[model samples]
Target: MKTTGSPAGTGETAGSEANGAGGAPLRLWGGRFAGGPAEALAKLSVSVHFDWRLAPYDLLASKAHARVLYRAELLDDAELAAMLGALDDVGADVAAGRFTATIEDEDVHTALERALVERLGTLGGKLRAGRSRNDQVATDLRLYLRAAVRQVAAVLTELSEALVDVAEEHVATPAPGMTHLQHAQPISFGHQILAHVHAFARDVDRLRDWDRRAAVCALGAGALAGSSLPLDPEGVAAELGFDRAFANSIDAVSDRDFAAEFLFAAAMIGVHLSRLGEEIVLWTSREFGWVELDDAFATGSSIMPQKKNPDVGELARGKSGRLIGALTGLLATLKGLPLAYDRDLQEDKEPVFDAVDTLLVVLPAVTGTVATMKVRTERVAAAAPDGFSLATDVAEYLVRRGVPFRSAHEAVGALVAWCVEHDADLGEVSDAQLAAINPAFTPDVRDVLSVAGALDARSAPGGTAPARVREQIANLRPTLAADHKWAVG
Candidate 1:
């Protein structure tokens, strides 16, 4: 498709009115109309407030586009040099917070373009020769998310390392592992914490994988069809640190799958964090008494003197909903639209931005919580042996003694029922009671009934046995190091 110009002339003619002087329109497309947009419409349409955060990426895309224009012979060497110098000025101003978007500047693109023209006159206008806001914003968003993915990944790595540190401290500490909110078996607390670390590790993997797709540049996908000029999109992509350029102009500007994938990753992170948060909440309660929140990461009730609430965990839980909303909202906005760009697409950034901002705050706060909070080892150990937690070990012992698992399971179930009825623990059951349940009863059966014995019995790979946990911890150290390198870089 051919690029369209303003009704009065090229985009340059619309640039003056976009400067917020007199009663002129606030948009770059104002030249196509006789009058300005209504106040309500302008207010609703403007995105410079939230999108101004994308200015740096916008400037980066502009610089690369200037080089492309120069190669296309649309910009002479002097003009190119002047444009680059002017972009530097604009970037510096933005970096210093001296340059900002005015109400008339509808978005980051128009705002920065106006800043450029203000600095370099017509040379600034030449930067738009073969570009469109459609492709420009697409390119800018990709660059922004690419950097954000790395940043989020880095923070995730820190969280994973924090978990590893805590896990290392408790590799031999036994705790009651639960399923369906009931004690199922004994496990090392380290193994339990590493379960979360593994989930976060997958999150980092998703972010890295998503970056590969997000790396494709969208600059040369002018308005709709490819640019008419002999633009080198691949060269611009390389300059912008992308792996390649868009193969289809329409898809480049319109596809928001990368953003959706990012939100999904963010939401999954929230889900994982919320699970951690929930455990923190439970562990800190009088019921569990497994952990205590650090004062720095906790908050007090408004009127209660004895309340130190796990606010960080609670917020992480609440923000998971927000992250889910972001993904759902963006998907709704992108639903059923025809190929090519639309103003509805403008609705994409805010939700994803909120997701990123939410994660940035939540990750570090949760990390601090995990790092500083006291683990009530004595309490965890005490609770580990209560609630018939050793029942499973008895069943497993019978399995090793040649009893079929189903038979062993039935025997253990009966034993558990007998203990519950008698208000006694398996450790309290006598040899006669053991033999009454099964002929396999022997004095050695009591050996596997203790928490430590149960834990040691699970010495297989990925088990909660002390040796296995220590081995997993050692293996995780190098994995954390490798993930940290990729995340930070």
Candidate 2:
């Protein structure tokens, strides 16, 4: 279950063309202006460094848009053939590290268009007629996220299965359930881990729903209006595998609702992972000692020789903040901006890119940490009934024996208080002490005191009872398998 990754911009590798500073400042739209952009503006506006990752997506949209242009008679048969040839060559060069963004290239769209112009002379410039970078970038981003969602989903499924693996093995195992960090009751260990699995399952469902709602193509929404040219937006949309072409051109180019939605989903996944990480941190602690992390997943302090740190869990907990920042930061960038398209939109990509990148790396580590951790069953079982956790069971027992509910509650509270005052274990209380606390406390009250009895007593569906927990684990398996297939397909 080993995993690896680099940061957002530092991928598997960067091409040589990716490293060079612009030989001279280049502006994509300089016809209206007398001169190139100022160095300061260029410095501020430059995005090719990070946006180069979108080259393939930009090229994909370009090819689709070219077909739209050709069908509209904007390009003759020979010219269309030549243009597509040039595009394919440029795509190959980009893939093989032969072509890439230099500082002079304003962005992916500009860089790739420059390559076309270099390859086919005037024939290359023909493809840019009906589209604006506004629409082009919007389309490219959708394409990127459309594919990236699957990757996120794939890893999400992996993490989910890891949790299920742990839960399946621990169905009948006892553990303390808490409210406000105080032991509240007894629960099956499997039930607790399955709770996390359910949260992640919702995240998977979210990504799928978001993908469907966001499958809109933006290519025909040139700038913020429909183009006068006889373009087939629907045809292009089909070619790009979008559900449909966007209905409103203005909303199409200006809308980053999809990006915002994606960030929200990614952030939610991070929050759930962080929760699991936090529990792992607590479980592995000296006080808890209920779980032990694998040596590969755990770390040690440099100076403190005896320190065995749950670094995976701690980092997983910490990265949730970063994922949240990406969401909130994107939301802030999106707020109050007048629409059709603005430079602020450029701010959308990096954060969303980073959120996905962070999750891709973090999820695998957390999954490995969880899947390999050694559970101390004796410790967990012993701790399950501590803190008079079975007090609720005692109350329930009294209720079943025809005692009034209020009277039962009072009797159990007194029994717990008596145990605390005497520094005596709750299980060690006698029938005489039970009768003294409240006549409802019969010898049979102790029947429900054992951890197994407490756990099995919760026999309702979705309860922590062993049989019910096993049912949940069984049902989750097929969903996990389907989610993996959907993610990969």
Tens-place lDDT digits, model 2, residues 1-489 = 111111122122222222223433334576577667778988898898898899999888888888888888898987788777778888888888887777877787877876766566556667889999999999999999989999989998999899999998899999999999899999999999999999999999999999998899999899998899999888999999999998999999999999999999999998998898899999999999999888999989989999999998889889999989999999999899997789889999999889878999998898899889999999998899888899898888988999888998988888999999999877798889878988877787777879998888899989999999999989999999998899999
- Candidate 1 lDDT, 1-489, residue by residue in tens: 111112222234434533445745335666557677788998998998899999999999999999999999998877788778778878888888778887777899988887776666555667888889999999999999988888898898899999999999998898989999898888899999999998998999888889888999999999989877999999999999999999999999998999999999999999999999999999999989889888899999889989989998899899999999999999988888988898999998999889889999999999999999999999998888878888888888899999999999998899889988999888888999888877786879888888998889899888899899889888888877887788777
lDDT to native, each model: 0.86, 0.86
In model 2, state the lDDT of residue 13. 27
Candidate 1 local distance difference test against the native: 0.86
Lowest summed lDDT across 10 adjacent residues in model 2 is found at 1-10
Q: What is the lDDT of candidate 2?
A: 0.86
In TM-score terms, candidate 1 sits at 0.95
Which regions in candidate 2 have their CA more than 4 angstroms from the true location? 1-26
Model 1 spans > 4 angstroms off: 1-26
Clashes (backbone N, CA, C under 3 Å), per candidate, total 0, 0
Residue 391 local lDDT, model 2: 88
